[model samples]
Target: MKRVPLYAAALGFIVFAGFPFYWMFITAFKQNRDLYVGAFDTRHVPWIFNDPPTLEHVRLLFGQTDFLRWVANTLLVIVAVVIITVALAVPAGYSLARLVGRWGGRLGMGIFFTYLIPPTLLFIPFSRVIALLGLQNSLGALILVYPTITVPFCTWLVMGFVRSVPWDIEEQAMIDGYSRLAVIIRIAPRLILPGILTVVVFTFTLVMQEFVYALTFISSVDRMTVSLGVPIALVRGDVYHWGSLMAAALFTSIPLAILYNLFIDRFIQGFTMGAVKG
Candidate 1:
């Protein structure tokens, strides 16, 4: 009998969390007449298929728009940004955690505070930098600009994670004649895998969702990321394509959802261990 409440609570939470995806799925496949007409008809059911589902929106998204290109661009940016974030954040974090001694925590916090500065404040200055570099309207602008937002915070995150790792393993490795650089390259990474995965996931999601810098720097249709491209392509001057918009969202979000599911355990471990220590 006690399990009933627990199951009920679990069910409720699932419904609450899963509702948006459910809504997106239904809306994406819903016919325009069914979707619009049902809104006016109070007796009509909104959640179920009052009319037969259609692939019209999906067709429009793929057939008419540069959605595939946007996906490719998004993937490209994600890969580059994740690589940059991991490469820079891991080393900076390790240095702050191990090499800098007592002041490392303060330094790490200082770096983290830079990440707290709102993107709204940074975009203007970044725009000038992008222009000066002549990267406007290009994927290179996004690649160049995204790291500024990701690196500082990720450095702090990695530093915290590194603190949680016991120094015993690395110390033993060093005593066994493993050079500092070799231990860092070979042994430290294995201990910090969870944190690296966390950074990768964080960077990937950030680049996928970021719109401000994308909008500020990229004006060309062909170069737009999915977040920027979908709305720009679908919403024609306040005339919203709800079905297509939902379709785009559904397509874009599924991969992210899957990624979270896959890395959820390690992701949680990374944050929790980091929080407890550094």
Candidate 2:
């Protein structure tokens, strides 16, 4: 009987958190009339599916917009960022964990602090740098610049997770004639996979949502990331393609949502343990 309240609370929380996603999902398929007809209909719940769903919006999203290119570009940026973040963060994190001694924690903190610095503050200088490199409106510029934001925080997160590994075991391996590099290479990966997975997901999601850099560096329609391309191409001044906009958003979000759900256990395990042990 006592568990009933707990169950109700959990259900309530799930609905609270998940309702927006549900609405976004259905709105993508709803016809324009079905959407607007209920706006002031106090008798109807606005988003409830009263009329039959249609794929017209989905069709329009693909037919009229460069959604395919946006997907390709977004994927390219995500892949590049994930590779850079994991490759750089793992070694840098391991170094901070084992090699840097007492100052390592402070150094890691400094790195993370850089991630906290507002993107707004640095976009001006970043734009200048991008211009100087002659990558002002290029997807390549995003691939190069995204690492600056992704690596620091992921490295710090990985440093904390690595710190959770037993030093006594590492020392025993060293005494057994295994070199430091060998021990790290063999053992670190085995134990810190959850942390690495967390970094990949985090960095991938960041690339998807990142706006300022994508917006500033990619002005050409063909070059835009999904984050920038959708809104730019979907809405014309004072005129919004709500249905197609919702469709674009839904399709783009579904894959990431599934990926996150698949590895959610590892992601949570890495974060909770890393925070406490770090």
Candidate 3:
């Protein structure tokens, strides 16, 4: 009897969480008229079945707008940020976890705290830097700025995962004539694979969702990232292209959803490792 309410609660939560995505999917396939009429109207709810679903919005998004270009630009920036973050964070995390030095741990914590500084506070200063470097409206600017937040948090996350790993194994490798760096390359990578995957996914997702920085830094139509492109291309002044907007949103979300599912096991393990002390 108790299980009945638990199941009911679980089902309710799932519906609450999943309804937005479902709506987006539905709206993506919906005719503009259907969306403008509003799905909440009971009168129009049945019209969803009567009206044949169309791929017109998806077709229009790709054909009319530089959506593919925007996607490519966003992907390029995300890939670069992920590479930079992983390369820098992994070593920084390991050093913070394994090395004993004055203020090592405190320094790691301090560096991570820098990420908590809101982008809103930094945008004006960043704009001045961008203008000076001539990176205004360039994808390179986004790539450079993105790592400011991704690296710090990712480094902190990886630090915890690295700390949870046993150093005795690395010490044994060192005693067998392997250098510390060699031991890390040969042994630590295997143990921390899950953490690395976690960082990759987290960094990718964060970069993909970021809007403010992309909006502020980019103005060229072709140079705009996905987050910026969608709103600019789909929404006119005081007018929203609901169908195309939904299609673009759905398209953007699909890749991330697949990535999450693919690495979900390792992602969960990474968090678990970070949370529990060995």
Candidate 4:
């Protein structure tokens, strides 16, 4: 009897969460005629599965767009951000948690607060910086700027995670003559594995979705990230390419979803631990 309610709740949650993605997936396969007919006709009974599916959209998208380049650029930016974030955040977080006595918690919060400053306000100054460095429209410019937003928040997250680790482990390792660098390479990785994975997944998704800075900074078709690239490149001005747009969105999201699902338990552990301990 108790399990009945639980099952019902789970079913409801699944429907709520999965509906938009299901809609997007089906919409991508929909013929343009069906899509526009529904859009234009008020009385056209909305039936997603009822319409005949087509691969024309997928073919048109891949054939006509610089989608692969966008995907490649997005991956490049994400990999660079992950490297910079992990390298900077892990060590900085460990130091903040262990070295600072009473101020570590407060400092962590302050660093997180910096991430809240809207990117809208930063883009103008960032654009100037990008131009001055002569990296305008280059992936390197995004690689440079994205870290400013990603690092502070990731550092704060790592600080909370590192704080949760039992100090006795490090202390014993130290007495056994393990250096700080050795602890970081050997012991810390095992201890903070969940936290590290959380940072990877979090930052990867962020770079894929973040747009304001990308839009303002990158105007060249070859240089745009997936978020900007798909919409800008696939559609002519004022004429939306719904099929290709949805197709791009579907393909881009699937990999992340699969990866997240693979490590969901660890991801949840990272969040709960960070929240409760911090």
Candidate 5:
């Protein structure tokens, strides 16, 4: 039947897409003996059903490395960036939506376009600025650098959401003896919740995943973020610790996965609203 091929194709695509993650999970538990065996070797290497799996890699990662410190540094920088982005972008977005004219739209577009500039191009100058400010090897350096990407896109996204909100309701609240700021504080809350959540999730993810700035600015072991710490701890000069590396990767990804699942509905709605309006 016609539906038979469609079902087969869907199953095929899922298998193809999921195989890598499945392999990584399996390999993370695999011992060095199993890993060293050739794939073509018919020596009965029980990769799939291998029991007595080791947690040595995970243990080594947590026990030997500054992983906890790296995680703390990443969380701190991400929290700071998220707070700064929300504080600056929300009001700026409202202004562009309510006060400014066509020029405001152009300005918002321009700000968003700045984010498209590759970080590689900006790193040298940014490094010089950091050096001048004496922030070299400090977590504060990441705090300053991360906002370059977070603010612009967030402002544009919030601007679209703000524009979509009906102003009549806000005006009525203002007429009912509420000050302008109070009306915005109260009525805007319901409508902008999705947009704010979008900003927080996107900004946190971006800051967490960023590498170039972190690599360039931070060299001290104690001050590194998770993205930088993983490679440094797991990769030696010519040797690679594949097991520990995969374990660290798996651990890092789990929290983000949970967060995405928790607020997926609002996240989707926020992005949809921004896209349709913009």
Candidate 6:
């Protein structure tokens, strides 16, 4: 009986958090009439389907746009960025935690501060760099720039995560004649797996959702990522393709949502522990 309020609260929270996805799901399939009805029209229920659902929006999104190409571009960028962030952040973090001695914490904080600088502010400078490299209108631009955003914070996260790991195990390995590089390569990684995963997931999400750099650097339709592509494709002048917009959002977001759910435990641990420990 005492648990009833807790269950109700949990249910309420779920519904509240999930309402937008619910709206997107229905709006994606809803008929034009069902969707455009005035809010004052109480005769039609807004929450439930007012008419039979259709796949027209889905077809429009898949058939009429470069959505698949955007997906591929987004995935490629994600893969490259994740690899770069991990390769850079993990080592950088471990170095700060173990190698930098007493100043590591201060250095890690300074690095994390760089991550806090808004992407909006950095995109202008990045645009110049991309132009210099001749990567304008290219996926390569995104692959290059995203690491700048991801690496700093992820480094701090990994540094904190590494700090939380017990030093004794790593010390024992070193005492057994394993070199520092060998300890990092062989043993430290296993203990810091959660932090690395956190960096991977964070980098993936950042690359997927980012728009400023993608839009600034990529002008060609085929080169745009989903975040930049969808609105440009769907919104023509003042007319909004709400159904297709919703469909595109629903499609792109579900996989990310699923990924987060799958790793929610580790994600929370990595984020919170990293912040607190640091």
Q: How many backbone clashes does candidate 1 have?
A: 0
In Å, residue 91's CA in model 3 sits off its true spot by 0.9
Task: Give the per-residue lDDT of model 2 (tens digit) for 138-237.
Answer: 8889988899888987888788778777788778888999998898888768778877888898898889989988877788888888889888867767
| Candidate 4 segments exceeding 4 Å error | 1-18, 38-43, 259-278
User: In candidate 6, which residue pairs clash?
Assistant: none
Q: Which has the better TM-score: candidate 2, or candidate 4?
A: 2
TM-score of each: 0.88, 0.86, 0.87, 0.86, 0.88, 0.88
* Model 4: per-residue Cα lDDT at residue 21: 82
lDDT of 1 by residue, 1-278 (tens): 69999999999999999999999999999999888874677898898988999999999888987888999999999999998898899999999999989999899888888887977898999889888999989999999889988898789778877887899999999999999999999999999998887899889988998999999988888889999998886676878888888999999999988887886765554445455432
RMSD of 2: 2.8
User: What digit string (tens of lDDT, one per residue) describes model 6 on residues 83-130?
Assistant: 989999999999999998999989988887887798899888888888
**Each candidate structure's count of clashing pairs:** 0, 0, 0, 0, 0, 0
Off by over 4 Å in 2: 1-12, 41-45, 236-238, 261-278
Q: How many backbone clashes does candidate 3 have?
A: 0
Tell me the spans in candidate 1 whose CA falls farther than 4 Å from its real position: 1-17, 236-238, 261-278
Task: Return whichever of 2 and 3 wins on TM-score.
Answer: 3
* Candidates 3 and 4, the one with greater TM-score: 3
Q: Whole-model Cα lDDT per candidate?
A: 0.87, 0.83, 0.83, 0.83, 0.81, 0.87
